[model samples]
Target: MRTDGGAAAVELTVHDEPCRDAAEVIDDGLGTANEAAAPMHEVRALQCYVRSADGQVLGGAVGRTWGLCAELQQLWVAPTHRGQGLGTRLVRAFEQRAIERGCRLGYLETFSFQAPVLYRALGYEVAATIEGYAPGIAKHLMTRVLGGS
Candidate 1:
């Protein structure tokens, strides 16, 4: 580490091991930030899975409720199941579950090349857009009103 014109320019080294366990640190940071944002509330994971006749998981959504919103962390379907409305069904079911858990809105982040159209068709509106993620790649943050909110 050295200083240039009184401005410190610190050298760095990459380590295979973490300085501390990341998960616990992240949880602690989240707890602190969430506490500052609002009174601590119980966060419930909401999900919906579609299975085959033999009970193989085919597609689903996973999300959790924070405050009054459902965070849509992931939604996916087997390639063989695409274009058949399974994605729609999964999203609908997830939103319904979020509603039951007292969430008044659904929030999700998606890449521009992904299912932006599908989410829009499901009544999600773009809350923010970031361009130039990598050339033509972009990121979209979307939200949908749930439970009449």
Candidate 2:
């Protein structure tokens, strides 16, 4: 996902059914109400992928932006595929995509059940912490500057 002040390009090396299905289901759930009321789609989404050398899917990340700020909506690496630098690679890829779209900053929220540590290590700083964002989960709001380096 490295950029050289040029147009953004996405490398979708893999596409698995589970992830695509989940995204469709979630989007359907959220978009139903909006569709009934507005009859339009107003949001754009992005998906970045990482693949093994032999063409197997390693992992990927997903995100979206409204304007100058982008929200990293979700990132997932298969349990057996973790710790192979896929997450970091996907992040760098998405960052490049966001920066190319004129994004200046990026942010993401992770719960205690997820990897806030990974986010921190990826140069995202804790912007806010919610004691109980979910029933038993602590939520960390993290942010990073895009194209700063």
Candidate 3:
């Protein structure tokens, strides 16, 4: 890429896989800009997992909390564990931790064929939706008030 004057050039490299260094750089840059814009810009990881008595991992919920909001990045339950309510438990646990961390709102993205119904049962409402995310599927951006806040 060249500047308007064509005196300077910049190179852009794309990676097939995740680049930790690039991620750190992006995080640092965003953190700095966000902190400059707001007082509550600190981000923290929040995760919840379910394990069996034999120590086998069953389900998990991964997310982050920043300011007054919590974002549920991913949630998964083992095929054999589906319909057992482990998903609900994991979500509740994740939300409980978020509430403890002072997050009054919860947000997450789910596919139409994924856990949108479950999230709705857990009090999440669709804030936005993108149709044809893949094939016949849709992407839903959901949100809910945590701890009645």
Q: What is the TM-score (0 to 1) of candidate 3? A: 0.79
Q: lDDT per prediction?
A: 0.88, 0.83, 0.92
Pick out the ten consecutive residues of candidate 2 with the lowest summed lDDT: 9-18
Pairs that collide, model 3: none
Best by TM-score: 3
In terms of lDDT, the poorest run of 10 residues in model 1 is 1-10
Give lDDT: candidate 2, residue 87: 88
Candidate 2 colliding pairs, count: 1
RMSD of 3: 3.1
What lDDT is reached at residue 19 by model 2? Answer: 84
Pick by TM-score: 2 or 3, better one? 3
Question: Of the pair 1 and 2, which is ahead by TM-score?
Answer: 1
* Global Cα lDDT for candidate 2: 0.83
TM-score of every candidate relative to the true structure: 0.78, 0.66, 0.79
Judge candidate 2 at residue 92 and give its lDDT.
87
Error of model 3, residue 55, in angstroms: 1.5
State the local distance difference test value for candidate 1.
0.88
Whole-structure CA lDDT of model 3? 0.92
